[model samples]
Target: MRSLTGPTVETIIGVVVRLLADERGESEADVRDELAEGGWELPIDSLRLVEILVQLEQELGVEVPADVESARSMRSVRAFAEVVLAACTTSDGSPSS
Candidate 1:
């Protein structure tokens, strides 16, 4: 396993921004700004969200749960990050910093 340090909210947001930009064919700056203004509700469709989650799982090496709770977490970027961070912490047996 990788020596995983828990990912920060900013890191998760950065990844999400990049993924959204790539998926939507937009610039990262535009996506970032939109997400900043939108806050809790992500601007993408469920399909895009799933694609991003798959990418996040690949990039971060964490298995994001596919249950209802996980779906609820996807309501916001920070919430989603918390879920990923929790997974990382669980896998590495380390407290999230």
Candidate 2:
């Protein structure tokens, strides 16, 4: 697997969070705090997290497993990216590192 880039991950998380915040008329800080409250290291709400994951999977052409429930898979932005990247690498016939 390719090394994770902090900026890339941060950018993705920020975009998703911002979108969710805007849609819900909530402050970004509140969203971040909610994720923290949920014990997520990267900090994001569950619905927004699922939306971001679905978007990422579509954009990246990655096939994330459907078996993992929404709560488990969308725990944090970092975890979401990790799972997507890993699933992409394996599902697209790329050699896994």
Best by lDDT: 1
Candidate 1 weakest lDDT stretch, 10 residues: 1-10
* Candidate 2 residue runs with Cα over 4 Å from true position: 1-45, 69-71
Per-model lDDT: 0.81, 0.61
Runs in model 1 deviating more than 4 A are 1-4
lDDT of 2 at 36: 64
Angstrom error at residue 19, model 1:
0.7
Candidate 1 Cα deviation (angstroms), residue 16: 0.7
Q: Which candidate is the best by TM-score?
A: 1
TM-score of 1: 0.86
Clashing pairs in 2: 1-97
lDDT of model 2, residue 48: 60
